[model samples]
Target: MMRITVSFLPSELLPKPLGAVAPDGQDSGVLPATAIVIDVLRATSVVSAALANGAKRILTFADLEEARSHAMGLRDQQEAVLLCGERNCQPILGFDLGNSPAEYDRETVQGKTLCLTTTNGTKALQAAQPFEKILTASFTNAAAVVAALPHSNQPIHIICAGTDGSITGEDTLLAGRIVDACCKSFGAKIDNDSAEIARRYWLQDEQGQSLAERLRQSQGGRNLDRLGFGADIQRCAASDTINVVPQVTARSPMEIAMMR
Candidate 1:
């Protein structure tokens, strides 16, 4: 049996393998297994909702300029596309929307392709692309992702794209959920340094408050509150809002499609 493991970030800051120095580029190396990347504060959650709402596709771009160019090209053909993302925790100027799942509701995103760029999530996905396999994960699709984990003999890595290049409570807590789900579903245990740290964080959150409440207390959570986006945080923290798993396929710009 392949031993499953999880790694919560900010990679370099976390300590040991749990917090490795995040790779310089996408070529981190062969993972020899699977990796589920998470940015539960909003990115991954929004991606899940967008796809569930019938988004034609989501094109994640690390650079805002590039994403805009792509969107402009898409628009030139008269195709309906929406440009959305955030920078410094606020909506970028001239974007169709920010990085909020509520903004991606069915009526808004259906039949549209999202051109997205963010401070961390996009960069994290790009940096971790060298892994053998990558999956996008969030609380919205935790159960489905748990069931979808590759059963072949290979380790699994859960990479949490924390906020502003730092590990926030929400992402680490989400990683903990994945780690716990794995332990219950696979009857396997993890030994990775990161998994241990994530497990501890999960247990801490589970001790008193509900997941949503815990998320509301995170660093990103407070920022969202001050910015009047508190509702978005609650929405993202809701468990199983949608049942589809979003996977990052082997393609450019890293499209997120429903894993079915």
Candidate 2:
């Protein structure tokens, strides 16, 4: 394995609420060729759909108060700033929208800026801040995100927005998909055991059960179900449904725009 940790390399890289797992057994410091942020339950999926539908930009914040402060400023500058986020899979009080992809329809989200703070996704973004390049992924846009990556044969890091500080199955599933995609696209090496395991998961049941069912089976998925948001899970798990790769690039504080 070209992956060696604590060789904790000279270069640095970066996740926040759904923080990246500690690189305990894997390479610690070497920066990945590219970092893939996964919040398969809803965050990245919603972002993909939001941008694809013409939403102006999504401003991510880990703190709800910070998001609120930014929302006020953005609203003052533009009338269309909407507060979107979740607290334990439910809408935050006084916010304009919940963290459901279906809620961000073209009519509501189009031509507007969404100030989003999710339980895991925004935290994941915070965690990935130091990364050279950050790309958001969800089953909803797996194929498109894979297609957008450079086939340069560099290491790809899949950062899962694990639920409540632990890995979630949905996030792993997409990471696996990305691993499989990279193997074919660039013959990328599976640097660690977790990455290899995720790849195997994606390989095991590509077409057996509906991805929605798999999502529903996850902790994040079941929580959504308990909250009567089963429909959101279906939307999140629909692979390749939206063909947008959300790349975080220069402009301003963590603004995600679809990379063409």
CA lDDT for candidate 2: 0.75
The prediction achieving the highest TM-score against the true structure is: 1
All models: lDDT? 0.79, 0.75
User: Model 2: per-residue lDDT, tens digit, 1-260?
Assistant: 22211101112223122233334655433344467788877888889889878888888888899989999997788668999999888899999998889888898888898889887787677666655677888887888887887665444667787887767788877787788877776667777777788888878954678778888898888888999999999888777878788988653568887785
RMSD of 2: 5.7
lDDT of 2 at 205: 58
**Candidate 1 lDDT over residue span 1-260, tens digit each:** 54666655535423333322234534343555677888887888888889989998888998999999999999999989999999977899999999888889899999998998987888667656656677888888888888888876677777778876667888888888888878877865785877878877787645667777888899878888888988988788778768787777645878877775
Model 2 scores a TM of 0.85
**Models, CA RMSD each:** 4.2, 5.7
Candidate 1, position 247, lDDT: 78
